[model samples]
Target: MTTLQILWFILIAVLWTAYLALEGFGLGAGMLMPFLTKSDRERGAVVKAIGPHWDGNEVWLLTAGGATFAAFPEWYATMFSGMYLALFLLLVALIVRICAIEWRKKINSDQWRARWDWAQSISAWVVPILLGVAFANLVQGMQIAVVKPSDPMTAVPVDQIDLAHDVHNLVGGFWSLITPFTLLGGIVVAALFLSHGALFLNLKLAGDLGDRAAKLAAPLSLASTGLTAVWALWAQFAYGSGQPLAWVPLAIAAVLLIVSTAATVTGKIRPAFWASFAGIAGAVAFIFTNMAPDVMRSAIDPAYSLTLWDASSSYGTLKLMTIVAVILVPIVLAYTVWSYYVFRAKISVDDVHPAGLLKDKIRLGENFLATN
Candidate 1:
């Protein structure tokens, strides 16, 4: 592969890593909202902990998708088009989760808040599970068959061209995406995020809430460590035979997972949170390492796999993208860091308020009608 192609591949991987690390905690916090606190005020505090940064974190997802579409159109086409249904559901879940976060406090009614809270919780759980399943399938390889454009001289229709046995269009149902290994991957990520969220709560809450979160984090971290170990080992044995170096990241991830659990048990919340973040990052690193050169592997025939070289855009395109990314990525990162720094304070029941966008809108409407 050209240097530009390699760079773009790494950049895409980094974007995904950032998304999973940042958004994982947000999702975790959302999932824990109803269970972590009985009082509405406490639950609002949980939402407040992540509210400032959750939207910013989701930008990574958009950037990753845009990067893939620009740098590797074929990979984007095959993956997105092939998994359209699953991705649609994921998008829906994200939308619901975002709405829940924004609208939960719009009214003072218990029933209104409770309805949105359920929406937030369900979507939070669903998004991570979907993402995990998708990642596992990517690692395990999908049934992808690239179709070539028809020759114009022969006047052959693109759809009617005879395809080789090993070459066909993307074909599979939702059931094809799920497997024992993928299910395990979903569990591993879900557990990891749960621990990460609990650790975050420990850091951003005080008093009884903080204590409960820390206690919850300990067991969740332990469970995550075990599940991650199983998933990593299985991936190594199943797919890393040719890529022996992939085991290094797997080992590092395992170590970090262990460290996270230990730190949580020792009541070192920050260390535990960072360890969990590093552990997830390491797991993603291992996956990309194992899949290197090949962007998408075909389970039926290895020869039909999509490699970075085959999937990447032209060198000039990548070079231009590189320039744009270099200019914009740092600015985005700086703003994100500044935002976090400014909002780096623990939230509590006292921080909860009934005022929201809906209230402002209602007042504006009343004023307009009165003036009229």
Candidate 2:
């Protein structure tokens, strides 16, 4: 592989890591809203804790998709087409989750808020689970059939022919995406995000809410640690035997999860959260590292696997993309950091009162405008 191909692969991996780390807490917070608080004001506080950053965090998802499409069009085409149903459901869940967040506070009716709360909760849970399943499948390899086109006039050599035009078909129905290993992956990620969110709530809330969050975070983090350790070992045994280097990140992830659990038990919320973030980043890195060189592995035949070198766009396209990314990525990171700094204050039920709804709406509007 060329240096640029390897660089783009690492960049894509970084984007996915950033998405899971930042958005994990937001989705976890949303999933916890209904169960974490007894009163509407308390629930509002839970929602508000992540409200300022949820939309911004979602940009990572968009950027990751865009990056894949630009850098590895074949990988993008096969993965998206193969996993169309799953991706469609994920899109719907994301939309419902976002809409619920924005519209839940527009009125004061209990029934209305309750409906939206369910919407938000269900979608939040579904999104992460699906993402986890997708990632797990990527690691496990998919049933991909690559059919090359025949062109007599061009007389292109078989070895030199690009498979971009090959018919990359996924075998089986949507049900095939669900399996024992993939389900385990989904559970692990869901548990990790739950723990991450609980720690965030602990950090951003005060009084009874914070105490509850801390208590909840302890168990969730423990669960996450256990599940992650299991998943890592499973992945290592299942796919990492050939790539011994993958074990490094897997071991690091296991250690980070342990640290996260310990810190949570000790009531060190910030340290616990960062550890959880690092654990997730390490876990994702392990998967990509294991799958490296091959962007998409074929379950049926190793010969049909899509490699970074084979699947990537033209050199000129990648060079242009690299220039654009270098210029824009840092600016986005800086603004995101600045926004977090500005909003780095604890919240309480009092902060989400009916009287403050108007201010919240105005602030939300400004955030929307600024992000757009």
Candidate 3:
């Protein structure tokens, strides 16, 4: 890979890892809804914990996609085309999940509230699943018809790569999305979010709600750490390397998991949150370490597999976008941190307005606007 390409890849990896960590907290938070909150009032607390920042967290995912498209067009095309169906469903789920939060207050009716609850629940649940699936696919590597130099954009002349006929391809595909590895990732993520929700709730809510959330946090966190360790090892092996290089991420993952669990068990909420974040962050680090160079590796022919250099956009395009990103990324990070600080607090039953003050701000004159 060219220096520019490597730099772009590194930057994209960092952005994606941050996105996973940042948005992942909210995902973990949301997934805790069914288990953590009992009533509309407590549920409101749950919503309030993430309500202030969830939208912004979502932008990272968009940014990551944009970066991918800019830095690695070939990889983008191959992934989107091969996984179009999965991506479509994920998009729909995300839409519904975001909409549910806004529509919840349109009416005060119990049924309306209940509908919102379902939306919240689904959003929380489906997002992590989609992420896990996507990661699984990343590890599995899809079948993409290699484009020859001249035929790169020749329309329908290229054949699509198929996973069904190849044992290695099929194994990789199943391994990517369906294995114990990714599912463990799913579970660990769920628990991490739940713990994050608890911390968010403890900071934002009070009375029975906060106490109950706190009670659930430690156990959820511990379980998640355990699952993460197991899956990290499996993922390392699955990615290849019979030698000890595979153990690097596994050891890092284990340490993070252990530290996260210990911190949570001791009731150090923020530390626990950070530690859990560390665990997930370590996993992302491992992903890069294991899958570097190739955005997508081929099970069929190693020669045909796409590498960072092969899959990337032109150097000019990458340099242009990289310059732009260097300016924008810090600003994005600053605002994200500022917003989180501004909104950080324990949400209460009383915090739930039929129309919350922050609600209008989120909508900006849209249908979900709060009266304020």
| TM-score, per-candidate, Cα-based | 0.91, 0.91, 0.83
Of 1 and 2, the candidate ahead on lDDT is: 2
Between prediction 2 and prediction 3, the one with superior lDDT is 2
Q: Tell me, what's the RMSD of every candidate?
A: 4.3, 5.6, 6.2
Candidate 2 vs candidate 3: the TM-score winner is 2
- Of 1 and 3, which scores higher on lDDT? 1
Runs in model 3 lying further than 4 Å from the true structure: 143-184, 241-250, 356-372
Summed over model 2, clashes come to 0
Cα deviation of 208 in candidate 2 (Å)? 0.4
Predicted structure 2: lDDT: 0.85
TM-score leaderboard ranking: 2, 1, 3
- Give the runs in model 1 whose Cα sits over 4 Å from its true position: 148-168, 356-372
Q: After superposition, how far is residue 341 of candidate 1 from its true place, in Å?
A: 0.8
* Maximum-lDDT candidate: 2
Indicate the TM-score of model 3: 0.83
